[model samples]
Target chain A: MSSKISNALRWIGFTSLEPLLKLIRGEEPKKNGLLVFKKLLVPILSVFIFLGVCNAGAKYLYNIERERKIENTRSVQGEEAAQQMADCIDSGDISCKPNSLPSPADVWSGAKTLVEDHKMITADKKEFKEKTAAINKKRKKQGKSPIEYTGRPSFVDQIITSLKTVFAGFLLAALIAIPAGIVLGLSETLRSGLNWVIQIFKPVSPVVWLLLVSMVIKTILANADMDKSFVISFISVGLCSMWATLVNTSMGVSSVDKDYLNVSKVLRLGVLSNVFKVVLPASVPLIFTGLRITLSVAWMVLIAIELLAQSPGLGSFVWEEFQNGSSDSNAKIIVAMFVIGGIGFLLDRIMMFVQKMVSFDSKA
Target chain B: MESVIEKKTMLECKDIKKAYPTPKGDFVVLEDFQLQVKEEEFISIIGHSGCGKSTLLTMVAGLNDITAGDILLDGTAIAGAGPDRAVVFQSPSLFPWMTALDNVLLGVKQVFPHATKKQREDICKYYLNKVGLGDAFHKKANDLSQGMKQRVGIARAFALKPKVLLLDEPFGMLDSMTRVELQDVLIDVWSKEKITAIMVTHDVDEAIFLSDRVIMMTGGPYAKVGDIAHIGLERPRERHAVLEHPDFYKYRQHLLTFLDH
Candidate 1:
């Protein structure tokens, strides 16, 4: 219940902050309300009018294209189904009952069957209309269409799930990365040794890691007589992604000032409190830098892993659409690409926001 | 001033000697350097460029070992660097990540471990304000100018409430005006805190201005305190007027001739 007030306060804070920010930016306030609207009128109206016209134009074109495709598909399937049913009746095949009408599966099969029958084709308006009418009647009564059972996740659902996974995984990685980086960064031997490991693995391709892990998981499952491919993929990709975080953490630790170390010694601050208060605050800039780099790496790797392994992620959604070879697939792929790029851009921006928040007061 | 005058002698260094092992045999910086500081005495050691005045101060601060004799604080020999003897180093040795208040609090909290959190905070703020850095207390040490940073360092050292405050050319890098201002501030704080302070510098006027007794060391290989001038100038002495005093100029010229050797 308190969340309601908090949300209201948050909204108010933002609303009130707008004018203050405008003041800081030195924007002059309108003496009369009409002047504000007058200043905004041209750009706002032009943008809305352009958007409205584009949206209307797009909707009209889409409706026309959809109607054409729907007409084409219905006629094509209806003629094929009718021809097959007639042939079956002539042959006294009782299972091919044309009077009862065909299922979508049967209609689809019939379309393939009647692909060779060329006489009752397009340009024959009466035949096409009659066929479409039969298909529509069948669809209304029979409760099925002649579309296939495509095993693809819906684009919107895929987006939500992928976003959830990325955030959860990135958070987990960060939680693990900070402490681990501190430990590695503080120890000289660990820093050097780990740096060597990073040098070897950081630049190696994510696709290569995905392929190797997939093959390894396949071999392991075959040997164990168990199928646990998901766990293996996550482990492989997680490790590949964690490298940036680990290296960055170590770097942060290594770069703490000599005077701070002396201060800690002189003050006799206990290790736990010292690490939390002094070391952590001092190393934040580098830590966030690492997190940013690692986050991007993890995202890129997750997509590559999903695409290569056919895992249930955004990558798989895009791949499945491209593989389907439908006329709509190219447009869907374009939409999916935009969605992927937007999500990545948003993730990096979030990291940048966090960096700003953490490092803001450090300057004085 | 009453408290400082009434304070007892807290530390004394007796006939201390320090030598470094070199290929050409032992090179001595100071030999039989005897200094007995009463409680709250403002003492300055001035000498030639490499006369090991800093080395002498460090040994007394327990940062370095004395070869011959020992340093005693209230009749006990100093073993190592401790809270009772805080040193303000030449360089601004503040933790860059910590704010001025936090840097001061580092020493306060450590020395008075049983003090309440609010008490420590107040103490830190009080000392920082005493050093005229009340406004810059929240600023990070690194962001401060060199003079301001040194003030923070001085605040940190004095917050320890040390029996012996050792300074190794604390204002060496500052400009003349800043150096004079800090010297006055140092004098004011010393008069108030009454902590026994031993500052090492090459500035002749600084020694005459600040110290109760100015110990001038001769040039090293084996330098010793060649002359000890008792600066009998009155309290609240003006620098220009004091320089024109017959006795002040006499002491300065005597030290200049002695240092020429």
Candidate 2:
């Protein structure tokens, strides 16, 4: 049982936990204890130290800004005016722009409020559903359809929207890039012919892609009542991020071992079988590396694309909060920043899991 | 007295030449390389490095394109790589993702498409067991040691049931102890199957232990067959007995002298 657990942990890349599990099974406790300390304890301690530094830094900056505001008011008005300004700064007034740099505590409170807001939105949705059902029953008798609920999206809703858009973009990228990469890798002539095009388009900025996609989509879908911004944002993300997958896949396919190819030939395998059996399996490691990079690029560019397209996502949430400029708006935006960063880390871990599953390289 | 029956030739290489085009000019690796083997005969090619022994073997396997002349298997001119000619490379080129059984099954299924899935699987398992890898059927190529990987490679080739097996120094990467062990395994399988075999090797003792005839190639810029020594050693030859034989040293001296020049 312990061995099975150890194997599972090793496969999932939690190799450090294996020693601890072994120690629990009464196998060299002292050695495993040292490993546990080095791997787990050290990282936890480092994180606490970092948080301590950030807390101290935030407090120091807040005090400095508060003092500067008081001094400015005193110089502009009289001593009486300065005291009122100091009181307002102490009370966390929104008028002071310098106070917008929220402390860690403020961001924490902002996160709590967002959670509460999500719960309230859920309650509202339930109530709306019940009300709609009653109204629909009455409308059915009158031969009328029920009205749709178009409420403001909660923070969680925006996050879900962002995830959906990014996935759509990544799917689009994979559908187009992989086949194209395979063809390019197989034929040197085709690769050379298309090299200039790939080179030119690869480095194009996400903002540029968004603008181009928006222009094209707007004209094409002018008559259709579709979600224009959603389509534009995802398409832009796909265009901006696909180059990594394409380049890496081509390189992977081109560098498959010659001996494996010979094996395929000797087996008298058809072209399709040769590719599936020999080319694809041999190049899986490199192709996964490419996919991981492509996913990360898609995530990074998603915010800019969403902001430019004004799509309903975490990116737009951040942008909207910034424009609103309310007292809690800064804290909310900071909350979104942390959320984005956390999601990005999660996305990378997911990709790493998938890459490990597919790759034959044990070290991966 | 035993009835005399003429053995038909299984493989023939007639004035084969292999050359690669370099920027300077055409670099000739092998010229007029020739050999013939009777049915079910084990032939080993021994030479120093750069003698184009491997190139010649690959040419027979239909992996490398012949610049001139032709190689025939059972009176038919062999063209591209086919299921009839299976090769075991020096590096044990098993697909890393596949388990030992799957690696063997891949070739078996490809060659014997009409066979039932159970039959194909049985063929793979049988050959893998023959190579002393019965327990490692589920072990991926990467998980296996170098010797084990080569064993899987041998199993894969044998499972295909090719008319002629070409080995390009299949045990070259292994240590001396493992190489000797695998050579014994190869001899056991070859004698049991009685398949026509052509092996390239740098090891003289290995060639002598495994082959009925050893062909020595001269050093290159255009290497050719220098000598062919027929081993008159008895079948099922034990390693200790072969070492003790007076004829063993004579054949070793003959091959060593050819390789030295």
Candidate 3:
């Protein structure tokens, strides 16, 4: 039972828990206790200390700003001006207002409000569907299209949309890069021929890629009435992120053990079987490493692409809040920052799980 | 000896030459190398390092292109590596990802695609058991010891049922005990199958114990066979008996003399 728990923890990326579980089972508790202290207890204590420091620092800054505002009012006018400054500060109407860095409590409240807003939008969507059902039935009977909901997308909807776009872009990149990488890996002449082109395009920025993609897509999709921003953003993401996978895959393929190649030759395996059985399997670990890097790059570039294209995503949300400059906008932006970071971390873990699945090397 | 020569000629290397282009100019490694083997004869090529014995074996396996001349198997010129010629490299060279059974099965299935999966698996299991790797059939190559890995390599090569077997210092990496154990296993399999075999080695004792005829090569820059010593020991020779044989020292001295020059 203890071994089972250890294995489960290892599989879930919580290998630090194994020592604790072992200690619970009374299997070398002293050693495991030391491991637990180092891996778990110390880190937890450090996080608490950090949060405490942040809390105290934020309060100290808030008091200093309030005192400064009151002193400035006293110097400019008389007791009336000072009293008004104190009142404005108490009411949270100082000039600095909500533009200051948000405290942890503010971010917490901001996340709560976003969740509530998501729930309200979901309820509104349900109501809209019910109301449109009757009209849609009549319109369908008359061979007319039903009306679509044109309300602003909620925060949750934008997160889902961004995820969908990144996946589409990543899939496109893999589709093009993996096969091209294999071919370049197999043929020396081809690799040399295309090396310059790859080198030139690999370092191009995501913003530049977006501009070029938009210009080309605009010309090609001139008459098509579609979500041009969505298409443009995803294509740009794919272009900017594909280089890592391509370069890594080629290197992996080229460096496959020469003996394995001899084994294939001695067995007289056909070209296609040789690739699938030998080349692909041998290079899978490196290829997956490449894929992980590509996914992270895609996520990093996605926000810039979305902001420039004005697409509906967390990037646009942050940009919009920055422009809005209201009392709560700073807190909301902080919340979005945490959400984006959390999603990036989750994407990386998912890729690691996939890498483990495809590779035979247990060390990975 | 007369009866042995009466048997059919199985393989031949005629006027073989190999050279590499270095910055210094043409660096010749082997020149005018030639040999012939009768059917089912076990021939071991013994030489010091840089003697081009491995280059000769690789040419027969069709892995390396000869700069001049040709190699023939069963009266037909061979070109390029194929299932007809299987090689066991010095290192095990088994795919680290595959199990011992699966490594052998890969060769069996590839060479005999017309056979059913069960038949191919049985062939693989049979060879694996013959090499004393029955218990390690499911173990990955990486998990196996150096000796066990080489056994799997032998199983893989033998499973293909190739017309000719090539061994490039197959037991060079093992300790002495494992080396003797594997050499016995190899002899048992070779005696049962009677396939034409060529092994290149630097071990003088190994060459004498395993081969019907030991060919000693001169040192490089362009090395050639300096002498061929025939072992007339009877069939089913035991390792201890071969070591104690009267003619053993004579053949050893002849090989040592040729190598020293």
Candidate 4:
């Protein structure tokens, strides 16, 4: 049972848990305890340390801004104006509050508020759906469309939307890049012919891709009944992020071992079979390396694309909070920042796990 | 009855040459090579390194382009690599991601495309078992040892049921112990299948031990057949018996003398 758990942990690329499993198995408790401290507890302690530093930093900045504001009021107006500003700041009035980095507690409170807001919005949506169900049923009987939910998306809703967009973009990227990469890999002439194009386009920013996609998509979808922003955002994300997978795939395919190709040849394998059996399997390690990079790049660039396209995702959510500039807005943005980073880390770990599973000889 | 009917020519290399263009001029590896391999022949080409023995074998396998002349298999000019001619390279070259069975099955599937799935699987399992990999059938090629990988390589080649088997020093990378062991495995399979084979080797003992005819090549800059020694050992030759044969030293002396030149 212990060995089985260890294997499972290793398979999922979670070696950090192995030490704890060993501890549970009652072998080398001191060694395992030390490992647990280094692996799990140290990282946890570091996170607390980081939060403490952030709390101190936020307080220092807040006081600095408050003092600057009061000094400015005294210089521009009078002593009375400065004292009034100080009182308003202490009272936590929005207009007089210092716009500074939010402490950990503020971010926590911001997360709670978003969750509460999501719950209330979900209830409202449920009520709306229930209220409109009968009328929609009548409308459907008369060959009419049912009522659609057009309410403002909550933070959680925005996160889901972001995930959907990133996935769509990733799929589009893999679809376009893999075939193109294979073609490029197969023919040296084609690879050299298109090298310049790949090189020039690879580092182009997501913002530019978003603009380019928007221009073409808007014109094409002008008369079409489609979510133009969503289409544009995803297309831009795919284009902006596909280069890593493209380059890696081509490199991988081209670098397939000559000996494996000999095996393919001796088998009298057709081109498709040769590629599927020999070339692709040999190239998969590098291709997955490329794909992992592609996914991370897609996730990284998606926010910019979403923001530029005005798509309903985290980008838009953060943009709205920034524009609102309320006392809690800084806290909300901090929450969104951590959420984005945490999601990106999770996505990378998932891809790493997948890469490990399909590797040539895992646990060999 | 004509004796020509009994002794059919399975492969012919007519004035074959291999050369590469270099900064100074053409660097010729082999030139004016002429040979005929009778059906079911076990021929070993042995020489010092860089004598283009491997180049010749690859040309027969249709992997390398013939810059001059042509190679014919069964009266048809061999084109690009085909299942009719199977090759076991210097290294196993088994697809690392696949199981040993799958590696063998890959070729079996291609060669016997019309065969039933069960038949093809049976063919793979049979060969893998022959190579003593019955227990390691499901083991990934990457996890297999050097000897085991070469065993799979041997299994894969034999499983194709090729008219001709080209072994480019199939056991060249193995340790001496594994090499000798695989030598027996190879000969046993080769003799059982009754397929004509041509092997390139620098190991003189291996050449003598495995071949009906050991064709020695002169050192390079356009190497050709330097000498040939026929091992007149008895059928289904055992290693100990062949090694102890009175004429074994004579044949061994003859090969070493040619290599020395």
Candidate 5:
């Protein structure tokens, strides 16, 4: 008993200590401080600080610009606009009093009044306009363009809307591609026949497909809103990358061990349960790998289509920035590129994590 | 007498003939192969490599369509492979995706469809424990050693409580030590469960040790049952003693001579 216990202890100690001992005996940890600063820490910290300063500066400039623009913009007193609109509606100055919620009729009547009589501004508007003219004079001397286009949505709104559209597009692509791929993969007749068609279209650029689909939808399906070009582009991306998933699933299913089929027979696992229990589970690793590849490709291809199709998404936002052709746009493009790449990496990691959870070989 | 008659005879193959189409012509693997298995009777078929031993087993398991003749269970012709018959192949044929317990549960649920989830779990646990794999129940089938995988296969077959258990060289792939250990465990389970078993093997001693009857097959295109010798070795035969038994060598010598042709 004592000998057995000693043997157990020796084995445990040897395994635990061997790696530490190897590390301790490793080549000298010398002269690394200077090398580390040059090779590692300096570059990392430099980029970090540079981005930090740039982002803060951009936010600060944007806020100042917004405040200046809002001040210059003309508007009735909130109290006065509300009172006149309420009185006009309540006292039957118009056909019907607009609701407290400010119906379209109320906004239109107010807009009409403002346009018809533009001399209603108080002294505060005059002072604001004088200050704006002074700033404009100072900017002309310094060689800067005058701020243009009041009433545009803020930069924050544009960024938020772009993010929302990208997410929605990703989800829509997954929903369409996965089931289609699974069905296509399981049937040999479908795989062979459809593969030819897929091969033909797969090489065609998603941008080309998006344009084709958009034109088709516009011509043939004139009933739906043409503004749903984003959905069209997303569907094109899904279709374009679906072949990878279909091929992988078919290959995975085809490669299942012959013994499993025989075992299924002996155990009397009927057709449907055999599919779920044996065929599906055995093919999961390959299928999920295919899904990961498909998702990543779809994500990238959809973004490209969105940009080319003039759709509402991060791709479109980035394209707009590039079209601006400004000095700041270069930095914004770099940021957006990183954002796109980071989201792709995050999505791949999520798929890999799910694969690990569902696969028979979870250690992978 | 009561146990012998009342106990089930799970499988009976009458003049089972199977042939394969070849480039040159047709090649018959099994011709007039017949077998009768009583409940819990461990029967083994031993023959040369191409003697159609496996072909016979497949027909008995209803895996292959018999070219001629019939396979019956309780005097009924088998429609196809059914849960009433469970097979364990030469290599552990457990689905690689399933854990050991899940593999057993697969068979249990199919055989006993009306069984509750809890009941199926218990049945899986009981059989896995019977095969001495109680602790490794959750390990994936591929991760197991050859012996452990076969153990799972055995547990899966037994868990279903099939009327007949068909094992095609279940221990043929294992090292000798694991082979004997598993053989002991299998016989013990067979004694308790009394499910008729038909095993096809190349090992002479395995046949002598496990089987009530060892059916020898002649070789190729005209392969048929060469001999059906009763091992008739006493109950719960000892491993080392059976190896030394004079009659054991006689049986082994007879099989060696029969398969040599």
Candidate 6:
């Protein structure tokens, strides 16, 4: 049972805890202690060191900006105004503090504010729903749409929106890339013919894709009732991130072992059967690698596309916070930054897990 | 000897030539290659490296284009690769993602299209067990060792029930001891199916042990049949008994001498 738990912990990539678990079970304390130091204590020390550096840096930058403001006040106005400015800056006033880089505590408080704001909004939304429930039921019976709250979204809502947009773009890329990659892999002629197009489009900037998508999407979806900015953001994200999957899939498909192909030929398998049963299964490892890269790329580009396209997601949230330029706004931006990074990491782990589930070769 | 009723010809390779155009001119690998395989006859082609033995087998299997003449299977001209001819390659060709049973069932399904699902599975299970892989049916091909993978490959080919079985150095990658074990397993299975078989090999002892006739080929720019030694050893060949047979050394000497040139 201990061996099984150790194996599970290693598989889960929580190897540090394996030694700790062993220590808890009172098996080999000295060796496990050394492992615990190497794995757990060292990483914890590094994190504290990082926070310490951030605290010092934020303090240094704030002091420099505050001194510059005080100097400017003395030069422009008088010593009295300069002393008054110093007093204001020292009073922990939000209006006068330099919002250069947020301290760790500032970020913590910013996250707290966002959570409380989300709670307030939830209460308001629930009250609005209760007030409209009877009218909505009547409207439903009459085949009319129910009323929706038009209030602002919270930080968590923006994260959920970003996730939705990223998933949509990722799905679009897979749907387009996998089939196109299979076709390209199957035929040398098609691969060569389309090679230039892939090479040219693969490295195009997400901001540029957003510009292009906007022009085309507006023209195409002008009469449609759907969200135009959402469509543009997701389409641009898809176009920006699909290249990795396309290239990897084609390479994987074309490089299938000759012996496997011989088996297919000898079996007289139909084209579809040959592709799905032989080609796809053989190429799955490469295909999933491409997909993992595509998902991560999709996420990285989504923020830029959302910022440009005015989509209501983390990208737009960060953009708004930057422009709002409140004393607390920089801390909020930092929070969003960490949230974006955390979500990207989670997305990659999810893709890796899915890849492990599908591929058979243990070495992969 | 006369009571060995004359078996009818099942496969005929007549004037088949394979040529590849190089920078200078056409390089002929094999020209005017001719042979006839009697029904249920096991024929092994023995040659040195680059002697076009594999070329002839692949041509007969309809994988390579016959540049000059025709290959007739039971009177019909062979066109392309089909289930009527199953090949066991030197490398394990089982799909790495599929289990051993699934790999065998892949070929069984293609050949027995009208067979019930249960019957197809039964065929796969039966062949896998015949290859002594009864415990490893659920293991993926990538998980199997080189020798075990070859066992799955042999199981897959036999499950097809093909009219002609082409063995291209099938035991070339196995260790000597595993080679002998798989050879015995092969002979045991062949005695039951007894399809027309053609194998290309570098081992003289393997040729003598398994094949009824061993055909030696000349070295190439244009390789051809140099000599044919008929093995009159009795049915249900045992390895130890075949090794101890007096005429076995004679056939082995004949093949080795031809390959030495």
Instruction: Return whichever of 4 and 5 wins on lDDT.
Output: 4
Ranking by DockQ: 2, 4, 6, 3, 5, 1
Residue range B1-261, candidate 4, lDDT tens digits: 223557789999999999988999999999988888989989999999988999899888988998899899999998898889899999889899999989899888888889999999999999988988889989988898999999999998899899999999887888999999999998888778889999999898898888889998889979988888988776698899988998888999999998888
Q: What is the TM-score of chain B alone in each candidate?
A: 0.93, 0.97, 0.97, 0.97, 0.93, 0.98
Error of 2 at B171 (Å): 1.0
What is the Å distance of residue A214 in model 5 from its true position?
1.6
Report the Cα interface RMSD of each model, rounded to 1 decimal: 3.3, 0.7, 1.1, 0.8, 1.4, 0.8
Error of 5 at B23 (Å): 3.9
Candidate 2 lDDT over residue span A225-336, tens digit each: 8898999999998988889889988988888999999998999889898888889878778777878888889999999888878899999999999998877887899899
lDDT by residue for model 4 (A4-103), tens: 8888888777899899888888889999999999998999999999999999999999999999999999999999999999999999887788999988
Full-model lDDT for every candidate: 0.72, 0.88, 0.89, 0.90, 0.73, 0.91
User: What DockQ, between 0 and 1, does each candidate earn?
Assistant: 0.22, 0.87, 0.75, 0.84, 0.56, 0.79
TM-score of chain A of each: 0.57, 0.92, 0.92, 0.95, 0.55, 0.96
The Cα RMSD in angstroms, rounded to one decimal, for candidate 3 relative to the true structure is 2.5
Give the TM-score (vs. native) of candidate 5. 0.71
Q: What order do you get sorting by TM-score, best first?
A: 6, 4, 2, 3, 5, 1
Candidate 5 on B173-218: residue-level lDDT in tens? 9999999899998988888887788889999888989988898887
TM-score of chain A of 1: 0.57
Q: Is the docking of candidate 5 incorrect, acceptable, medium or high quality?
A: medium
User: What DockQ class does candidate 6 belong to?
Assistant: medium
Model 1 residue B180 lDDT? 89
- For B1-261, candidate 2 gives per-residue lDDT tens digits of 322987789999999889999999999999988889988889999988998999898888998899999999999999899879889999999899988888998889888889999988998999999999999999989999999999998988888899999999999899999998899888888889989999999999999988899998888879998889999898887899999999999999999888778
Cα deviation of B118, candidate 1, in Å: 3.4
Candidate 4: C-alpha lDDT:
0.90
lDDT of 3 by residue, A1-364 (tens): 7778778777768898788788888889889999999998998999899878877876787687678777877998978989987887788664645246667887788889889999999999989999999999999999998988878788899899999889989998999899999999999999999999899999999999999999999999989999988999999999999999999899889889998998898898889988988899899998999899999999999988999989889889989989988777778998998899899999998999888877877677
Please tell me how candidate 1 rates in CAPRI terms.
incorrect
Please give, for residues B35-109, the per-residue lDDT of candidate 6 as tens digits.
999999999998888989998888887788888988999999998998899899999888988989999998888
Task: Report the number of the highest-DockQ candidate.
Answer: 2
